[model samples]
Target chain A: MSQIPFTDIVANLPASVPFVGPEQIERERGFTFRAKLGANESPFGPSPKARDAIQTAIEDSWEYPDATSVTLRQAIARHWDINTDNVLVGAGIDELLGNVVRMTVPPGGAVVTSNGAYPTFNYHVHGFGGTLHLVDYRDDHEDLDALAAKAQAVDARLVYLSNPDNPMGTRHTADAVADFRRRLPTDTLLVLDEAYSEFAPEGTNPPVDPSDTNLIRLRTFSKIYGLAALRVGYAIAHADAVTGLNKIRNHFGVNRVAQHAARAALEDQAYIDALKNEIERGKRAYAEIARRHGFTALPSFTNFVTIEVGGVARGDRLLKALQDRRVFIRKPGVPPLDRCIRVTVGPEDQRTIFEQAFAEAVQEVG
Target chain B: MSQIPFTDIVANLPASVPFVGPEQIERERGFTFRAKLGANESPFGPSPKARDAIQTAIEDSWEYPDATSVTLRQAIARHWDINTDNVLVGAGIDELLGNVVRMTVPPGGAVVTSNGAYPTFNYHVHGFGGTLHLVDYRDDHEDLDALAAKAQAVDARLVYLSNPDNPMGTRHTADAVADFRRRLPTDTLLVLDEAYSEFAPEGTNPPVDPSDTNLIRLRTFSKIYGLAALRVGYAIAHADAVTGLNKIRNHFGVNRVAQHAARAALEDQAYIDALKNEIERGKRAYAEIARRHGFTALPSFTNFVTIEVGGVARGDRLLKALQDRRVFIRKPGVPPLDRCIRVTVGPEDQRTIFEQAFAEAVQEVG
Candidate 1:
């Protein structure tokens, strides 16, 4: 019998997953890690209120989730001082990114993003058959001017930029981002991912511009809100963008627990503030550890610290050495960033254990 | 600034959601549903083991879900006595259906489905720019033979058939479906949606044949498994089909709680068997209620019963009257199925309230 033919775009796509979970690593390695610092997950768990909300929502799992996610969407809108029409809730930023790619990028359409910056976004672009124009990072920060220039040159449909970016944990100032947006072509949609915004200092994110039809700001509960596994995220954009997303988004994709938990997490600003303080302390501790090994830690605004590990080969050796010692960590895969290992800021105890493991890995790799 | 133009396909698509959720109706009507039988969600709730698993998983909400969904996929594969490579887990069958469309139906590609079978499937087809070839249902069941003939006539890339069908609550025997599959073109992919298979009697679903590359059978936890809000579903297909889906699926879209809860729910066979017996009783009760109103309840093999409401006008009138009484139920939007109203087989208490409301609705409509 003849096999079903895949769409041309999907037929030529790679089978590799965007990011492997730490759980998969543990399964393959046949043991649990002493510290789970990779993937930039929040080391502090969700707030007590959010956990309680999740437990309370458990028995209600027989009902379908509110398709519009009205209450959660309203909460997010109120939190950002924006109208409800400007917001769209989804399974996470990853799912929302996929929808955005589908919305703006037709087959063979052009998109732009920094090289080695959020592989998942690039995966979505490529999955939808968009031609990606990769602009290399300059000095560990996404090159906004270069991205804008490339978007103009290609007449790109979409351009992605994550402020307080992943891997390097570096960020562009809000003013810089606003300037970048002003420089981009009027019709090019800029996907401003603020997944790590909650961990960043004030003034890192631009004010919500609901009138800007060419911008969509994505935020997630996965970072400071600490509900990554719940898969709740939202996009703040012009009402037109929101309507475009609603036309094709899986209405009931976000689960009931995620809705309730995220609302509770959003209400608990004190918990977030306390967690941010704790994360700052952990960052300082991580930086100190790097200094102890005569290494440099990149200035970071996000929850993770990227420590320069001499060179590309040394970074690879150090990463593997840490894994061998039952410590989970990640290093960037691209050239300049490959010389640094990214580590999540954990609680004091985890930080202590990770520091010891890092010291040992460094010595062994040397 | 010029608005970021949507892809031509998306730009032309209407901004209509597939289903108006009960919660959305409650919000619009400014009251809670007295009897929510509209969405066909289980009133029995999830298995106690599954509830326990969800509670246990809440603490780990900081971690991203296993991207591969390895353990749950393996459990589903073993339960069906199929190889793990044949299984693909997703947020729900809705998400899986979208991926299947993406896998096979290119832009302007032809697809076949029963008219008014499932609007969500049609929504995905239209969202992806596929040309729909809709065949009318025959005798309250999906007309598989007609669907196959149309698929061949149109050179359709994908055809959807839901056994133990939704909205109508009717099904075809396994032998009939097997014959239907044989009549289809070798290149056409038959998406056999067995969402309600657990509610059907034995010999309804065809035996798993992983060698058939053109057939993919879908099952969900939202119906008999009683975890609608958790949003977990899986497809059993050939490894090639599985690989194609993996290439484009949102790898971490399925949440951690869903993975754990669905696995526990699957293991609790006793809960499902007992729930099925309860559902059968509820169906009989519903039929009796229909008889009291001089209506006919069609032969049902699913959790819901579709009662003939005399004519299209009465079906529309009764549906509105029921909503006026705060009893939420649905009817097929296309004729001759539009002459019927579909109601979920809720627990005894819910059924009693629904019976009263339904009786009131029929009297008012008449």
Candidate 2:
């Protein structure tokens, strides 16, 4: 018998995952890594209060989560000094991106972003049949002007920008980003992803203004709160935008324990402050390590740093050597950025292990 | 400035939740529920081993979940005697339904289901711009023949059937369901939601047959495994169908702790068997209560039963009266089913409280 036919767009989509997880790599290699620094997950775990909340919540696992996620949203709204209607919690920023793409970009609609921005965003665009327009990075930073210009040219429905961007830990100033948003067409929705906002300078992010219907800010507990495994992220946007997202999102997608833990984490500001300090210390140590090895460490405002290797091919060789020595790290696949390897800041012991592995890999590859 | 425009599909869709959670109702009413039995979530709770696994996994909450959900899917595949590729894990059956609708239903595509089968599935169908054709229930059971006929007439891209149907808690035999599948058009994918299968009698659900390209069977850890709050569900289908789902699913939507807990829950079959016996006892007690109240109880094959009141208006009054007394429960909205109140079987203490509340509610409403 003939097989069922998939919708035209899905039938044509390639069966691909945006990123290969470290666990996938371990399974393939038949061994565990000595230092796991690939995905930029926080080496320092979640706040103790958050951990306690999750342990307590395990007994209630038989109950369905609140479909509206009212408590968590209210907490997030308080954090931003906005109403609960302005916040929408999802399983993660990834799920919110998928919903945003579906709600704003119709099939075959245009979307614009930096060429090597978040691949998962691109995946959602493709999943929804939105055409993506890529603008190349200029001087190691996302070309905001270029992105705005292309969105205008294509009449794009959505444009994405990440502050303290991934793959390369470069950030544009708050004023620069606000100016970029102002330059975009009113019809074009600006997805301002601030997953690393907590790590960046306090003034690096524009103040949360839910009055701007054309912009939505994405934040996550996955980074500073150190709850990536919990899969909790949220979007702060205009009330109307949140309503649009609600119409299409899976109502129960956020886990119950996640909602409780995220709220607990949010309440522990002291823990987050301490975590930032530790992250700064790790960044400084990484920069010193790079200086000792005669390599350039990119100025980073996030928890990870990009160390410039010689070239793309050399970077690939170094990455392979590091993998062989049981150190897991990732690199950008796009051209100029491919010259560097991205390493997440781990705890002291893991950082020391990464340093040793990095030195050996450089020697062997050279 | 003008607000950004939502996509046509989302703009036209209602910002409505499929089910109003008991928590939402409690918040609105300003009181706690005496008996929390509204959503059919397991009142028995999850296996102790599953709770232990979640507690152990809490320390690793900083890492992202395995994007592939490899271990959980492998365990599910083993349970069903299928290859790993035949299993697709999702945050919950609700999320899997969203992906299925997106993959099979083009804009304005036809879909068919009972009028009140599962509001969440209907929500997804509407979210994707699929036109749903409703088939009314026959004798409180989903009219399988009518559903198949409607699919044939509408050339539906998808058709949904929930064994041990929701709202009414009635079920059809395994052979009858298989025959209905055989009758559907090959292009019309059959979405067999077996969420309550564990509570159902043996042979009530058709065996897993991943070789059938047109059928996808959805099961949840939410129901019998009692992990609804953790939000893990899986689909057993042909490898090609799994590929189609993978091309569009949120890869990291499933929580890390949820995955581990679900696997442990799956391994504890002895606990499940004991839970089943306890549920059966609860069902018997519920039936006796209904009889004493001079109401008819529908023959139930799941954890919940539908108690028939005199009429729709009476059912509404009873529901309201129960709410006023702080006993949480739900009833169907459509005409025939609306004449009945659906109550979940809870633990002995909760059940005793519910019985007293029901007696009071009946007296007050009458």
Candidate 3:
């Protein structure tokens, strides 16, 4: 063909989104989101120290960020008590996930994930031409044993499991995850995404075992650290996987502001603690709101609540109604999951606003 | 078999850098560069408006940036008189180049570029397992005729041409480039990297044709926009290429702060004009410094000047000498061009510091 040709794999892939940002919805609706409670971002904002670091970084905004990300990685490695050789930082979990798919999954290779799991991981797997083997969530938590079994059956190259999971905002115990890790096929690498680990109850993160070739755990400053807009996330992996990432990843992908902000954010444990409490309060408020609306709010460990509005039609209408009321939120994509709406923890004021909006939205939808 | 294996291409690739960032050199030397005249970053810094935008945006660092990047793309499209569909923003030209390489070139397919041109593009090609065909620069400008020939010879998927070239700091006229664009094989994609275009002489950028399927021109906030640290760059291409990018890109890759900074940077034409003049003055000062040191300063259209230090040994000695004196500058890696050293335009005070350091270093090395 005379025109440029994407690789056949790329050619066959649909133009898809990992997630639809609330900004796009606001623009489409021709109004700003009055209560932004989607995307699981921390409403408490980044640590004051990180914010100050960002402001200070503005003057030096012309210099390229450190490509090797030596200092920041050192900070991250220290925070986890791991060596720098085991750490690799990237733009975010999203970018790192892409690298994971590219590195481990060959064309036509199989991968396993929860059916309603992090769509971004599945998106990346598809982008890399990997055929996904989906195992549905069990009790709103990723079916770990099912994932391992499917990975073994398909000889899947990689299997993804997010702890304190998104959408459902449920969690698995660290001991249970560790046991799950031990049982997964030795050859199939496990991607343990702990993006919400800081907010989960203590011990949600299994002890780091750099020698565990079966695992690579992903972490982020985007959740309790409140630096999602800064886009800094990293993975703790076997040195081989880390080295593989070095070979194919964007070396200078991390921005300068993010490097400094992330380091500062990591240093502030007090901030993470306070935000955890606030998120806990918000989740409780969401559950209360769901009760008032005659719905069930799933128990959540992360900073979001998933409320079932009874069925697909009710959930869809309520989502639309919330949008009409200028309250931006998102719903799970797959059915059963789609029968619920996911709302991120926002400020208490935002909670009240959403509560009132939910009441009116339900009445209007009904 | 027990561990996760990188795909064969990634496994075979070396852990390498497209460019060794100056920060790495400083760490090795155990001292910071006093002049900081490498990396071609703007010493003038981002515009006050952009800086203010960055400061303002820092508070919202918890919320994710727009994945679609609608507003910023709209503003960029309006700036270039193109549709939003015709533009795609990425982390930087470095990233967009990677995307273009992935989209156009299949494994083992051929791509073409100047031998000593942007090494980053070559790194991406190699990362994607695309065999690179190199044509040496003719007269310090990318040999457009030669590049076109090479593209056809290899049935190259993409050919790169950098106008207002880096390292050598030379440029081709817009009309000449337009003609070159017409001559290139229709089947080959021309990656016109105009990173230094704004600082080039008037008529440096010919009008782009969105219908021109053979071309995808890259523009960056890293250069004239003075927002390199923020990592914003956009591509002007046919809608097809842009659509392909969305499928594979890290959707929220562009940090929220960068979007605001780049938009503000683009809107402030007055700031750009002033910086251009400042850069021009700095380039002249470099020429005067080179004259004093018995070197020839090449005519430059970009923010950096390439000074011929007589021969390879002298260039090598001078580069090491300058580094030892806490002045960081770079030299072209290939021979002939290796006889020259590249120095970026810095602040007036920085120029004096570099000038004094250059004189002492030259004497010491001699």
- Kindly report which residue stretches of model 3 are placed more than 4 angstroms away from their true locations once superposed: none
Q: Can you write out model 3's per-residue Cα lDDT over B2-42, one digit (the tens) per residue? A: 86757888988998878788888988989988888888988
- Model 2 misplaced stretches (Cα beyond 4 Å): none
What TM-score does model 1 score on chain A?
0.99
How does model 3 score by TM-score? Answer: 0.98
Per-candidate DockQ vs. reference: 0.86, 0.86, 0.75
CA displacement after TM-score superposition, residue B237 of candidate 1 (Å): 0.6
A1-366 in candidate 1: lDDT tens per residue?
597779999889989889877888899999999999997888689999999999899879999999899999999988989899999999999999999999999988999999999989999999999999999999999998899999999999999999989889999999999999989888999999999998888889998889999999999999889899989999999999999999999888999999999999999999999998899988998999999899999999999999998899999999899999888999898988899999999899989889889889888989
True contacts kept of each: 0.87, 0.87, 0.79
Considering only N, C-alpha and C atoms within 3 Å, which residue pairs clash in candidate 3? none
Quantify all predictions' global Cα lDDT against the true fold: 0.92, 0.92, 0.88
Residue A277 deviation, candidate 1, in Å? 0.7
